[model samples]
Every structure is written in C-alpha cells, then in structure tokens.
Target chain A: MFKIFDHTADIGIEAFGETLEEAFEETARGMFAIITDGSKIEKKEKRKIEIPFEGDEEILLVDWLSELIYIHDVETLVFGDFDVKINDVLTAYAYGEKYDRNKHKYGVEIKAVTYHMLEIKRNKKGVTIKVLFDI
Target chain B: MWNGPLIKIDEYRYKIPESYKGKGNNLKMRVPAIIYASEEMLPSIKKDDAPEQTANVATLPGIIEKSMAMPDIHWGYGFPIGGVAATDAEEGVISPGGVGFDINCGVRLVRTNLSIEDLDRKKIKELVDELFRNVPSGVGSKAKVRLNMSQLEDVLHMGAKWAIENGYGWEEDLEYLEENGCMEIADASHVSEKAKERGKSQVGSLGAGNHFLEIQKVAEVFDKDSAKVYGIKEGQIVVMIHTGSRGCGHQICTDHLRVLENAVKKYNISLPDRQLACAPVKSREGENYFKAMACAANFAWANRQMIVHWVRQSFENVLKMSAEEIGMHIVYDVCHNIAKLEEHEVNGKKMMMYVHRKGATRSFGKSRKEIPSKYRNVGQPVLIPGDMGTESYLLRGTDEAEETFGSTCHGAGRVMSRAEAKRRWRGQEIARNLERKGIYAHAASWSVMAEENPDAYKDVSQVVNSAHGAGLSLKVARMIPLGVVKG
Candidate 1:
C-alpha cells in the first residue's frame, strides 16, 4: 500500500508497504518523496547499516529514525529505501543511502518527525504505521 | 469540538459566539471568544484544535469578555497554548491545566555591563561550561540550597524575597521581579508537605524539558527609545533564565487537579475536557486551589530567583570578577503559566477577575500601574526565548494589549513532540552538530536534549513577528543565543 498525505505547511509524505521490511522502506521513500521528488533519482548506491535496541518495538522505532537523522545531518544524505529485517531480540538490520539533489527533486524541508499521530498498529494480516512530520 | 458562531470583529481579530451554553462548555460566557492571528497562521491554529479550546474556555462559569488566544496560538491540553481567559472574581472557575503543571513557569532578563565582543568565544565557552556545572539541570537535578520543612515554607511564602533575605540575591533585585518576587497570598500551609519537600532542595537548580539558562547577545534593537530605557544595546550580553516551580509546582497541580476533578461534578460544572475541570471561585475547593497554586507560583518565582543568583555566581567564578564589578542586574521577570486576580474593565465597570494564562505571558502596556515604575512609561518588557541555535526577542507591551487582557505569546511553542524528535535525531550527534555550528549544548540527558531540539519548536521569529504585527507587543531588541545549558 502506498499513500501520500500532507503533514504541515510544506511537507507531504508517501507511506508505502507490502511487508514489515517493505513498510520501513516505504517510510524512507515517503520521507524523500516529501523532501524532494524521489522519482528523479536512479537507484544509485546501496548502504548497509545495523541498529540495535532494547527488545521493545517503541525503542526500535526511535533508534531506526535516530540513525536516519544522523545520516542526514552528517552526510547530508536522504535515504530512499528501507529494507529492514527484524531479527532475534528485536534487532533491525537495514540498508539504504544519500539522495542526490541532482538525481532526486523534492519539496518542503522536513525539520523533524513528531509523535503527534505516531502509531504502529498490527492487524491479523500485517502492521501499519502512522507518523506526523514537522515541516 | 464545538464550532460556535464566528463573530467578525475586525481585520486582525474575530470571535466565537457564547451561544454554546449548557453543552459541556463550562463558562457562563458573557462575551464571545477572541483569537488573534493572520490568515496564514489560522490554518495551523485550526489544525491544533486551538479554536475549540478557546471556545471551551469561553464557556467557563464566569468568563468575562472573550477567551482570548494570541497570534501564536497552537493546540494545547486543556486551554490552548496561547489562551487567556479572565473570569469574574466571585463566580469564575480555576483549572490546573490552565496554569499548567509547571506553576509560574516564567522568564527573567538579566543585563551585564560588558558587550558581547568583550567576551571572546573562548570566554563564552568557559562561561557556558561553568554555568552547566554550577546550575544543576536535567530531570530530578538537586540543588545546593537544602532546606528543612520550616525553611521550605519560608521560601514558599516569601518567593524571591526569601532568596534575597537569605543572601542568595540582592534586595534591589526585588523591584525587577513580578510581584516583587513574591505572590502575597501564597499560604505555605496550603501547599502540601510533599510538595514542600520536593521543592526544598530544588531551588537554584534548572529543571528539565524546555527549561534553560541561556547566554545571549543583543543583535538588533527595534525600538531605540524602549531599548535605551531597558538598558539594552546591540552586542550586549544578557542572560535569560527560563524554568518554573519544578516538582513542587507539578505536585501541587497534580494534587489540585485530582481535587477539582472530584469537585467539578459536585459543583455541576460541565467541561468539554476533563483537563478543564474547575470549581467556582467562591467554593472551598476553588479557594484552596488558588491558595495552593499561589504557593506554587511563589515557589517558582523563588526557584528562578535562586537560579538567577547562581547564574551571577557562575559569571563571577568563571570571569574572576565580583558580581558587583560586572554590573549584573535583573531587567524583569514575568510569569507565563499562571492565574491571577486582577482588575479589568468588564461591561464598562472595573471588576476583579481571575486571569488564566497557560502558555501566555502578561504584556501590560504603559500606564498600567501594576508594571514597575521604571517601565511604567514604556510598558512591561515581554521576553520571548527562541531555540538553542536561533535568536530570542525582547518586546514591550503595547496599548493594544489591553484588548487581549494584557497577554502575549510565551515562547516558540513546540512544533514537534518528544517521541518524534527522539525518533528523528540522535542526541550525541545532535550535540556534535551544534558544536560544529559554533553552539555548545550541555544537557543532563539525551532524552531532554532531543525533546528541546531547535526543530522541535515553531519559528520564534514568526511568533514575535506575529505578535509585533498584531500590535500586541512591540519588538525592543533581538538576542542571539551564545550558549545553552538545558535541564
């Protein structure tokens, strides 16, 4: 499932999902889609990163985004994909990377993520995450 | 949730009707609700559900005139973040959330003789480091000033005056403080012993979450005359202490909210939000809460006073100069989260009313005798602090402020929630990033650091701009943060 929604003044995100891993991937694609038009970027580089959290879903979610924020700040990279695997003990191994401005065009700058509408609801078939961003 | 009538007042102001009576709205609202904002800001205001909160506040038992919101309005728990409502003294109701959990959470301005250029970046860095060490910060941070039960009561009742008598601050400082550093009616007996104990050792300490001790340099002066009168100049160093009554205030609000929640049903007062639970001003519950909340407010004033003393000490210890030699003096202190009894024009008659300002500051204009004599001619100085990386502002109340019950926006209200900020950013790296930007942040924990990130707040410039644009306040000077010590 993929959907685009307006968050605030100048931000729009496209939420995507097929699997749990696919959902995380979709969140990043959605973020870049909001930040810049990600359709312009070709799949240039694939980077691998591992994130460990206490065996809790909430902390896992926090750690995942903290990692992304670190990458964005330090390397000025906006990842377009999230291929996450939740292994034993709630560890998440994810791979993705830098969104080239030349390759990917986007819209309003996302200052930060907010917990206003944050949720990860699990149904019989799968899970869905609702997140709000500050633009 | 209720959309009452939209009463068009003027270009910059509008009102919501008082017709939503007996429908969970509490006020016997005599007048419509008033909101100040531009067309651009209105969408965000509506998004936060602020209008509903304002309308709900308007429905309070004895609310006088409109439940007012400033241009920087945003959605907040019970009362909208920038909401202000004044109710008749005998019939008005008081709610904890209206004053917030942090009672008397306020801002104080301090001026120094030295210009910003006199303190090199290295000196400023040292000053900030010293402040971080000297002023205990973060969650549950203790203070050097320990007090017994009796001494705690003294602080509670005396407020900043207690600090002065104890040699923590100077007597002259009292003049610059709101209520002379004391709210006279704060009965120590009204404050629970538990609240007293929690506050006993917390004085002179900076509490956590959006609370800070900042060193700022004035960068712009918008009103030359007012700036001169305020002793503010371009490149001048000033300190802004922003915190509140800490655990004492929080416990007081918690305790009272429980009491009010029970009494509201007894009083047959209906409210849209339980957070808006209140009791009539004449009721015992209401009186007790007011006295107790006043004690908390005084405790907060004392807390900030003691912190200001330590801030001076930090400057003295780090700079190797006596505080007297450095000419460190408080400019003014103003409370944001509070409800106070004041006289206002109600139905063409001067009536005593309980003014509830949750995330709003008093912006009394010139000629309001309540303002200090020094500023009586220029209006009260309204201090608005921005984020760690940006500039804060010094504004003065304008004559137009009377239309909004002498109120203004408190600070750059949060744009992001804590959980979301933590999710989006790493504390350690964020600290490092700030360092690269020539800004240093000393926080007790990362949890708090992420919550108070610059992006977590609205553009304070926009907030101040809206305030000035609306004539509620006039900008005096802009101060850029030199360093931040957060708790």
Candidate 2:
C-alpha cells in the first residue's frame, strides 16, 4: 500500500509492505500514481530493469525511484506494476505502455526524488518508507 | 513551526544567535542565522520552517558569517527557498540542495518601445493569444528546436553565446546577463547521458508550476534616475520570462545528489538532514558536481535566450513589426538558484568563497565591477517577480547587501501549499477573476492557474519593502501584469 502527503512546496510519498521488495514495488506504484491516476495505465509492455546495489535500504530505494523517473522521461512510459527482486543487487520488470496524453492525465510534474527526511523503517508490522520529491 | 529563539536585531532584521541549537540533532550552529523581514511579515514567516531551515544551514561546515534568509523565505526541502550561504572555497563544502533542482532558475526583463496607451485592449488580448500559441508551455511541452547530441554539448559550454551564434538572440544580450550567460567551468563530460536526453527537446519550452511569461507595464517609478538607467518609463510595456534548465537541470541535480550522498559518508560529515548532502570543495566529488552544475546553469541561460528569441518572433508576428523596430532589448537576467565562486572581503581581507543562492538574487551595489557598465553607476538591476495578479518590482542593488553576501529576495514567496491552493480555488474561476481585474491570463491547464493564484503568495510590496528597508536592494519601479501565459 502507498499514500501521498502534502508538502509545502513539493509532494511526499509513503509506501508499506510486508517485505523490502514489496515496499519497493509499492513505492514505484505510488510515484506513478502521483503522475496520473493508476487505473488508466494498462500493463501492455514489460521492460526488464537491473540496478547493481550494495548500500543501505534508503539509498537503494532512491536509486530505484530515480531509475523509474528516468524511464518515465526518456521512454515516455507510465508504469503501473513492478515485479521487483532484491538480494545483492536489484533486478526487476516494469510493466506499462507508452504514455498517451489523450488517455493519461497528469498531476504536478515531480522534478526529482529528494533525500529530505527520507526514512525506511522495518518493525513488527512491516517495512515502511517515506520520501520527498522536488516538484 | 519554528520555535527557536530569535532576537530582534532591528525593524528589518532578526538574528538567531550562533549559540542556538537546531530542532533535530541539537547541533550547535557554527555561525548565527539572520533573517531580513519586516515586523508585519514575521507572522506568516513563522508559520513555516524557514526559521528552522536557516538555523540548520548555520551548522554547515565552513559557513562564513551567518546563514541568511530573505523576506521571501519559505519552507523548502533542505534549505529554505530564500536562503543564502557563503562557504570558504578551500575548507567549505558545496551542497546541491542549496542550489535547488532547477539550476539557475531565474528571471529576465525585456523592455519594449510601446506603452500601455500604444496598444488597445483588443490588441493586447490578440498579442497574448499569439504568444500562447507560439511558446510551448505547460507540462510535457516540447521545443520546436531539436538539438543533436553534439550541438547540445555546445549549449552546455557556450550558454547564451551558442544561441546568439545560431541567430537566436542578439550579441548585445550577453552584456545584460548574469555571468555573461556562461560559466567558464562548465564541462559537458561531467553531465550524464540521461540528463542530456531529457534536455534535448526542451531547449525553449516554458515549464509549469510558477514559471510564466508575463506582459507588464510600469505602474510606478520610485527612483527616477535608477528607473531611467534601467530603461523604464511609467506606463511603458515590458516582458518578463521566468524559467530555468527544465528536466536537464533536474536530472543533473538528481544524479549528483547520489554521488554526494555517498561522499558525505566517505568524508565523515555529519548533517541534520540528508538533503544537505555535500562534499568538501577541494574534493574530487565536489569538483565534479560543481562542473556538472555549471553545465546545467549554462543550459538554462541558453534555454532562456532561445525562449526570448521565440518571444520576439511572436511579437513580430502579432504586431507586424520587426523586433528591432519594436525596441525590444534585454534589461537584465538574474539567477536566483545557483552557487558561484566569487571574491568577497571578509574581516577586511579579500577571500574567495562559493556563494549559494537558492531563491535569492545577487544584488551587487553601485561601483561593483561585476555589474554592466551601462548601469554601473546605478548598481545591478534586481528583478523581483510577484504572483500572477500582484505587482512586480524592479530594484537596484545597495552597498549594504555586502553584509548579506550581496543577496536579496527573489519573489513573493508562497504562503499556501499547491494542494491547499488547488482545493481552495478553481483554475477557471481564478482565470475569470483575473480577467475581471483586466489581467488576461492563458494557461496550459486550469489546475495550474489555480495552483498559482496570487492569493497563494505573500504581498510582494511588503517583501520588497523589507528588502529596501534593510538596504539590501532599493526599489526603482513597480509593474502590474497586463497579460500572462503559463505552463
């Protein structure tokens, strides 16, 4: 599950899941949801994504979201679902199709994911992550 | 939100002493944090985290004097929007957060021969419509000029000079631009392919979210001599372009931030916020980020130059007059978000420092060699843009700005969040309301119009008044919007 929060000059997102990978996947969804209504995105195409990582969960999460932002900008793709696997490195499949302005509506354009107050906590319930974006 | 102790320095200044401890981490600031504001503006300023952010900035290593916030200060990610800090070049560190994501995000004013009386209401409306059609604005707006990879590199290095060589703008425009529109340290190699790809097709596009192209008329002139030097006359027409490097700068900042995030650990630098990730100025990582940042800054200058060219074309097409005949000339361009290496006097000794101005304009006083020769006697022209329907000011830099490292407020800072503004007002309603006030507004989307309602910001008049009272910058002229186009 994921939710959006109001920032004075920007936007914030919080994602939760039972596992780290699940939380990463949900975070991806949450970011896309900010761009457009998630229901409009059809998972017609699948693109494999691989990120080499050996760092704290917070840095890895930022890396994951940044890669998604790049894909969204360069390939004009709006991803709705993510199949993420994590271990020594990250390898996943992003499912979405080309963005159609006629079909997809956009909210505020997020410039970049910021590290301000970025936190990832895993407790008795689950793993949760909070991040901010420069709009 | 900011409950820290603040000592009133004067009617226009307040000081958070160096002994004050920040909210989080309880770090003792290395220097004091000073804010420039009038007594009336303090209530709204205290409603946000501007004071906390300012105090946090003072804790950064090698910060000179004090961490400063202008009257327009508001809550931002790491540093307050209207924050300014100068760090030692040899021992200080450079933080990307201090520069913001939109590198060199700034504003420039262009003077025209025509006055309000020269154009009828119908003509003004037609001109605005033509401009809206000519300039690609709003979200996902692509540029008409698509640059190849090699040509894009030239823009990274040459900045506005590249545009001039390509016949986009006049050569004389460079003199009026900050840093002559190019930083010599910019290196294309430091920029990533992803950043380049995102910027390739966005060269001249006006971005969304507070960025705008407005037609304005000089409504009041406070200083006759300074206004004359700025080529301003009461009721004269002018155009203000507000935007930056767009996606390219955003990606550049994002890419470097990851590097600096690791650098912070490597250098063992402690911080109250991760967003303030930084590296020593002399470190390799810091040098690379600075180089890459310079490229983004140069790209923004080129982007604005190209947009100005298109704006001139739109005017020519609508009025059936050549640009030269229209007397369109750049007054000055100011970068509100940037970090620059400059020489300043410290304790009576001249020293080089990296000055980071997130949402503050450089206000060099009269006789400063950095200002344009044409207006050297009057000082640098500071452009402070207000909200959509509010009044913008043209000011002259004052010598007292030296105390603040030559900086002043950038705009009428936000008082309401975008989400809150959107909830309170409808874009269509806001546009209609502006029309009722005789201000024609054309926006890519109604939501954008609503998000940028004038009521969402503080009164620009009061902000400028604070700056003037503090002797940071002196008001020369005030302008009211005639027509505006936003993306």
Per-candidate chain B TM = 0.95, 0.99
TM-score of chain A of 1: 0.74
Query: Residue by residue across B86-194, what tens digits does model 1's lDDT show?
Result: 8889877877768877789899999999897688879988999999988887533678778888888888788888888888888899998878878888887777765
Interface Cα root-mean-square deviation for all models: 13.6, 1.6
Q: Model 2, B131-176: lDDT tens per residue?
A: 8888888666778888999999999999999999999999899999
Q: What local lDDT score does residue B232 receive in model 2, on the 0 to 100 scale?
A: 97
What's the C-alpha lDDT at position B222 in model 1? 86
Candidate 2 ranges with C-alpha deviation above 4 Å:
none
Model 2 residue A7 CA deviation (Å) reads 1.8
Docking quality tier of model 1: incorrect
Q: Model 1, which residues run further than 4 Å from truth?
A: A1-135, B1-11, B19-30
Local accuracy by lDDT, each model: 0.75, 0.91
Instruction: Name the candidate that leads on lDDT.
Output: 2
